[model samples]
Target: MHFKVSNNGTAAVLEPYISMGGHAALLKNDRSVFVHLHPIGTISMASQEKFQENYTQGVLDREDICFFGFADDSTGNYFNSNTSPNGEVNFPAIKLTTPGNYSIWVQVKSAGEVITQKFDFNVIL
Candidate 1:
């Protein structure tokens, strides 16, 4: 897989040359921080699925009502589209609060199998 990284102000923009999939993650080396990323955004698939189920069952109103546990006001509009374009997965900026080493594990699915790539870098204060 080919990946290109560029800086967009404070965020590191990632352009991975592979079909976008779910279950990508970034982690601080000391295990102080971890973020799960999706092709759309940080919102999890299970959460989105639950929101859809609730909305369909009439258990929740479609406007301005937030459910508990990771549900936000934009939950209804979430998962409406994929943020990444063709042949590239765009991740939000990488923000490390402290100066340290970090590793990013990006997973993509191809031919019904999962491929994982590891990238390591350091953050200098």
Candidate 2:
């Protein structure tokens, strides 16, 4: 999932651009589970950079999960340096402890405007 910053109602028209540094994400599940994520994902920018460096150096001990590869290319495709961008915002994978409906709110400032989007989903075994 890759989010392309754009103005209201129009997508192809990419917003001039801004840093994702101050973006925020809030997720709630029936008031039971809640989490706040930074623009970099679930961790701070420093932490994300550390992991990226480690991966680049091949210092990770486990091979099950890799959090390294997010790059924007000339084709406006952001991928794992190989995969293609699909226009869906990529959020950190989440684990729900219980089964219920959840709502996610993502807030970001793009082109001097604060944009917020709400998404709802269901969790089932």
C-alpha displacement of 115 in model 1, angstroms? 0.8
- TM-score, candidate 1, is 0.54
Candidate 2, residues 1-125, lDDT tens digits: the string is 34554445554222211333233444555486777754335666698678779978989632333222133332233222322122223445667777778887765444445567777888787
Question: What lDDT is reached at residue 75 by model 2?
Answer: 23
Best by lDDT: 1
lDDT of 1 by residue, 46-116 (tens): 99789779989998765553211122323443234322222334355556778898888876543345557
Q: Ten residues in a row with the worst lDDT in model 2?
A: 78-87
Question: In lDDT terms, how accurate is model 2?
Answer: 0.48
Off by over 4 Å in 1: 1-20, 44-46, 54-86
Kindly report which residue stretches of model 2 are placed more than 4 angstroms away from their true locations once superposed: 12-22, 44-69, 72-89
Cα TM-score of candidate 2:
0.49
